[model samples]
Target: MLGKKKPLIRGESAWHKGWKDLFPESYREVSFPDKLLGDLHRADIFTSCGTTLEFQNSPICLDELRSREAFYPKLVWVLNGKKFKGFKILKHLPDVDDPRLDPYDFCLGEHLSVYRRAELHSGAARPLNFYHPELRNIPFTSYYYSFCWKQPHRVWYEATCPIIVDLGGHFLYQLKQRPQLGESYPYLHMITKKAFVSQYL
Candidate 1:
């Protein structure tokens, strides 16, 4: 819907440019007035469905994260997971009932803590039966995958909006987490890139 091609902004990374190129110019760099702050907020991509997609390449603190969420209520984060050297995507859901997985060796809210199961069993267990008191709340039916990230930015755990990571594969993984007994259990939900793009287009 754009009449003319807009000039590229300074220091815009190729990662951002690549994703923006997939959409029409009108949807890329769409701006909205922040009446509460008397300023304008520009979104990376604003789709026909009114969902604002923010392409994040670097780490951001909790304050900025909250501010962006507040400014754009219907927001979805498309993060560049390749930049994170510590981030590792393990095989699909591990067996929580496996005795090798020591329930006592986990730290509250740490993603790496639970990934120990992946190292121990590596998706060898069957049926996905979870008997441990700490694992009771998790929804096993979801397309959840175990992951381990060394010292992942804690701010992401605070994100209230949907977040999907681009790890340079055929699919984008949605980061799903739930707080139980003051502890955090984070996992990944895989969706093909074709499916993700088709939905917005």
Candidate 2:
């Protein structure tokens, strides 16, 4: 009993473990005991800046989502975008436009909160091809893109904190939801993984 092995946390995946490994050992799996709730909440990575990164790979109920947000005031959800099979990222907002759509609808893209006639691909294998070999090269800068998720987990929309998505690429996307006419619109900010990790370190 003195040298017992600890069991892996329930629902922990290799992707979760890999993200945790990037941080210092002390910052990983830091738990806070709450007297009022009579339960402990362990953050995947509690940064020195007092931000808790919660890596969510599965669908979470509204109750649990609100509870965690309340528990960790400075929380940022690091969602596993790969979990959603129907997630698709379209081209940058600037290059995409359809003559069929009205000005307002065209600007919003093919999103749930709005309707548009642009025939975006159901499934996109890569991020927007902003670069072309024939064209002169310019340093790449991060840009926001409109996305279409088949059945997105809307629970995250109610969250007060920031939500960063891991799309398994050279970059991590920060999901920003803007409220327009009492509806939530989704957009992704393309950021380099190195830049994101550096802030925590």
Candidate 3:
């Protein structure tokens, strides 16, 4: 019963020379230590959201640090799981080496896709009767159960908690621990799906 949306795909752009012109005015005066800049220059790719930056090489960039300042100042708030505007805007660039050309992927779908999949896999199962220690801590059970029972209203409420609490918890932890590194979508997708299964179904 769920609808599927097409994925958004973007290609990499040409490399730019200086941080001074590329970043916002606020970041003009900021300086990257020489070692970090050297690493960035060697990287095969660079990708960033307003709040996070990922590089293929060992070096980090000054823009990434500044992006964190704008998007993740509090460090605890969950960023809305939305696509970055830069992904689409940068897609318009003609040059392949444009900084915005970093390859990126986005899947389009409603939040309930995960919840619905869990429900399908847990047909006719009673709530809390299943024994799975790994899933005991996940908070999406209520939503999954509601969907299984054909109760759409309950599904909405239950779905939101797990999506926020379970996903947000791990997301923040990862950002805090690995702020400079970028994650591939497939890896994150698998982790999120597995977490949803563990918590609810």
Candidate 4:
């Protein structure tokens, strides 16, 4: 339901380059070629495994992150001010969670059409999740209950944690951890998601 996009602060070219450079040997601006409800929603990078990604150079709150999970697999946000006009903007805007407001902002329907399609096409018997575990800010039981409505069977509810990397004290990168239970979203343990303290540094 959190659908208010920040004022457009970044250019298309910067966003395209940023996301494309991060994930090499992957498809660029890969999107649903076929016409959906309206103009298609394109992922910045489509991994070989069909996991989609969108890079944003903007301030994305925890609730906003959860709202976006209903669409794509992950969103790599730029923490550096030098990246995008002092802020980030994404190429494709995802749909608002509320079905009524969906004007193809997210090509997938509220019924989770994209997730179903990916599951059907791929042979991997992984969990068919609409939202990524790193983005779901809700309680454990409530989260699974919603997933049930989206994917009842044949999907494993594997969760993942994130490793936030402080990029030279200016930028940050959130690397996702392996999927498992008891490992919740990273924001829970933080006073603020922007606080970057990495042991590796």
The reply for model 1, stretches above 4 Å from the true place, is 1-8, 94-142
Model 2, span 1-201: residue lDDT tens: 497544556778888888888899899999999999799999999999999999988889999998999999799889999888678887554322223213222234463223222323333222222233421132323376778877878887777888889989889988886543324456788889899999989
Cα-based lDDT for every prediction: 0.74, 0.71, 0.24, 0.36
Off by over 4 Å in 4: 1-10, 13-16, 22-26, 33-39, 61-64, 73-201
TM-score of model number 1: 0.73
Prediction 2 global C-alpha lDDT: 0.71
Cα lDDT tens digits for candidate 3, 1-201 = 977732322332121122112344352223333453353221211213322222111122446534433433222122222221221111111221223223221112221211122333446322321123523333431111111112122222221111222122232111111011132111111134235223322
After TM-score superposition, the amount by which residue 73's alpha carbon in candidate 3 deviates from its true location, in angstroms, is 3.2
Q: Clash number for model 4? A: 5
Q: What's the C-alpha lDDT at position 46 in model 3?
A: 21
Clashes within 3 Å, all models in order: 0, 0, 10, 5
Q: Which TM-score value belongs to model 3?
A: 0.17
lDDT of model 1, residue 127: 28
CA-only RMSD, every prediction: 7.9, 8.6, 20.5, 18.8
User: What are the clashing pairs of model 2?
Assistant: none
